[model samples]
Target: MRTLGLTRTSPVTFEEAERVVDEDGHGDAEENPDGLARVYVSPEVDGWTLVIGPWCDPCDGERAPEILRLCTELSVRYGRAQAYYYGWQGDGSAWLVVERGAVLRRYCETGEAEDEFFALGDPLPLERDRREQLRLSLAAEGSGDAEFEDEWKWAAFDLAPEIAEALGVNPLALTAETRVRGTGVLAVTPHRT
Candidate 1:
C-alpha cells in the first residue's frame, strides 16, 4: 500500500538480495514479518523481487532526488528496478522504471499537477493512451478543462496498479493464484538507524 519495487532477476537467492538491503547498514539487519517500516523482499513472484517500503517511495518531493539515485544504484546491481507509490486518493501517485542502470521513466503526481523533477522520460505508452481515452470521453460530454489538463497526473492513480501489472507485478494484487517462490522477509535499511 505504501510502496512497491521490482527487479528482474534470475534465481537470486534471498541472501544475495539481502546484501543490497543491508548495503549501508550501520546496524545489524533485522528480519521482521510485518514489513511495515523495513524493506520486504519477496521471493521471485512472477520473476520480480518485491522491494516494499518507504525507502522506495517515488513521489515524496523532498526525497525524489535520493529515490532516483537509489533506484539507479539498484538497477545497476540487479539489472532492472521499478517502484511505485500509490496514493490513497486520485492524486500523489508515482511510478519509476529503470533498466540496466538507466532510468527509462519516472513520474509522480502532486495533487492536481505533476512534480517536474519527478517527471522524466516521455510518458509511458499506457500514459499517453490514458490521456487519449480521457480526451475522447471528455469530448463525448463536449467538455475539456481542468480535468483534461491534469488527466496525466491523476490518471496515474488509476493506472499505477495496471502499470505495475504490465511491467511486472502489482504488489497489491498478490493472491494465492500468483506464482510465488520462497518467502518474503523484512530487511532493515542501513539508513533506518
Candidate 2:
C-alpha cells in the first residue's frame, strides 16, 4: 500500500487545512477565513478525508473553489475513488468527486455517494456576457427580502436556458414538472452511451 496519492498524517486541523495549496491559481485561503478545510489523501485509494472548521460552507464564495480544487486533485491522482468526496454539513461544508472537469458525484455525512447533482460544465462562450449581466443584477439585489424570489425568477428565465445549453441538458425538461424529465437529461455513466 503506497498510500494512494495524498494522506493525512494526523487529525488535520483548521489552521493546517487553510495553509493554502497552489495559491496562485486557487486564491488565498485566508480569503475564506473560517471556512477553511483540509482533505487528507491516502496512497492506497488516494483516499481523502476532509477536515474543516466548524463553520465552513461549500457554497460560500471563497471556500467552494478550494473544495473544487481538492476534488480535482483527487481525481487526477487516484483515478476515481468511489468515496468521491466527503463534507460535514454540521460544519456547513461538503465534498464532491469531479473528473475531467465535471463533478461526477458527491458525498456528505450520509452513507452513500450521490450523483443526481453535478456542474453543467463551463459556461458557454456566448453566455459570458449574459452571465456577467445576471451576476451584476443579482449582486444589486444582494440579500434583500425579495432577493431569493427575484434571483430564482432570473435564474429560471434569464440564466437557465444558457446554462442548459452549456450542460447539454434542457433545464426546462429536467425538473419533475417538465414532461421531458427523466428522458433527456441523463446520468453520465461509464458504460451508458
Candidate 3:
C-alpha cells in the first residue's frame, strides 16, 4: 500500500509503530502498555471511548451518549481512562493510526491494532463541512442557543459520558437539547448507510 508516497510490503515493527505514534504527538510509549494500538490520551480524554458506529441506526447515536454517561460516572470514582479504535474498510484490513483524532495515517504494511489507525488525508475541511451542516440543522430545529462552548463541552461529554453526567441531564436529552454554533468535536458520527 502507499504511505506518504512510498510503497511498502511488510508489517511495521514495534519500533516503526512507535515512531509514527510519537510523531503524531502521542505521548511516550512507556506510558502505553500495549505499544502500537495504545495511545496516550490525557486523563480527561482518557475517560471516554468515542463510539464510531452501527451505521443508519440512531441507536448507535444513542450509544455514544450512553458511553458519555458511563464515562462521567467512571471519571468521578476512577479518575480517568483511555481507549482505542481502528478502521475496517470494505473487506481488506491493515495498519493505520488515528492522527489528532481526525485524519488516518495508513501503514504500507500489515500491523497489529489494524482497526485502530486511520490513513492520513484532509480531516479539517470535512470537519468544517460537518459543523456547518450541523449548525444549519440545529438552526432548522429552532434551537438558536448554538454556541462553541456547548460544542466543546459536548465533545468532552461525548468522549467521557460519565464525567459529563456526574457533573446532570441524562446524555440523550442533553445532546438533543444541545446545539452548535462552532464545533470542537473532531470525530464526526460515522456516515450512516
Candidate 4:
C-alpha cells in the first residue's frame, strides 16, 4: 500500500476524524463523495483507526516532513499513531511510530544511501531480531556486504506489515474476520490539492 495512519485511540466519531483532516477549513469534509485526494478513515477496524489516502502518503520525498507533522498531530490527540508506506511498483518501505506527539521510531529505506527524510529512532525489536537471524545464517555461509544488504533490505520491506500485525493491526491482512467496529468513511485530508 502507499501510506496510512493508525491509532489505538480512535476519535469518537467520523466527524472527529474529518475535523483532523479539515484543519485548513476548506469545509470539504461535508461528504462531497468526489474521491479526489481524500483521506479514508477506517471505523475502528480491529480497534485501530486508519487514515489513508493521497494527502497522507509520506512516501513522497518532497512531502515527508509535512506528512509526518500530520501523523504526529494525530498521535497527539489519539495517544498513539503509526504511519506506514510501501512503494507500489518497487522495493521500498517506511514506517513511523508516534506517541503523544513524539516520534517513538521512524525508518525509511528506499535503496537510496542518502535518504534520511524519514529514518529515525533505534531499530525496533523485530528489526533487531531479524538482523541477528540474518547474521547467523549469513555467517554460516560466508557473507559479504552484498548478501548482507540483500537480506537486511528484506527486513525493511517486511517491517511495516509485520510490525503492524504484531503491535496492533495489519492493513494488508484485514478481512471479513477482522472484527470491524463500524463502517469506514472517506473524508478530504486538510492539505488536499
Order of candidate numbers by TM-score, starting with the best: 1, 4, 2, 3
Q: Is 1 or 2 the stronger prediction by lDDT?
A: 1
Cα lDDT of model 1 by residue, 1-193, tens digit? 1222333234434565455444422233354322233565777799887876556777675566777777787788778888887754554568899888888988776564335556777677777677777663424221335555465445656677788888889877877888988866655454433
Off by over 4 Å in 2: 1-57, 81-95, 105-193
Model 1 lDDT on a 0 to 1 scale: 0.64
User: Number of clashing residue pairs in every model?
Assistant: 0, 8, 25, 0
**All candidates' lDDT scores?**
0.64, 0.33, 0.28, 0.63
Q: Which structure is stronger by lDDT: 2 or 4?
A: 4
Model 3 C-alpha lDDT per residue in residues 50-120, reported as the tens digit of each score? 22112111112233333333334444454542222222222222212222332232211122222223223
Q: Candidate 3, 60: how far from true, in Å?
A: 3.1
Find the candidate with the highest lDDT and give its number: 1
Model 2, C-alpha of 188: deviation from truth (Å): 36
Off by over 4 Å in 4: 1-36, 136-150
Give the winner by TM-score: 2 or 3. Answer: 2
My TM-score estimates for the predictions, one after another, are: 0.69, 0.28, 0.19, 0.69
Error of 2 at 97 (Å): 2.7
Error of 2 at 30 (Å): 16
Model 1 lDDT-worst window of ten? 1-10
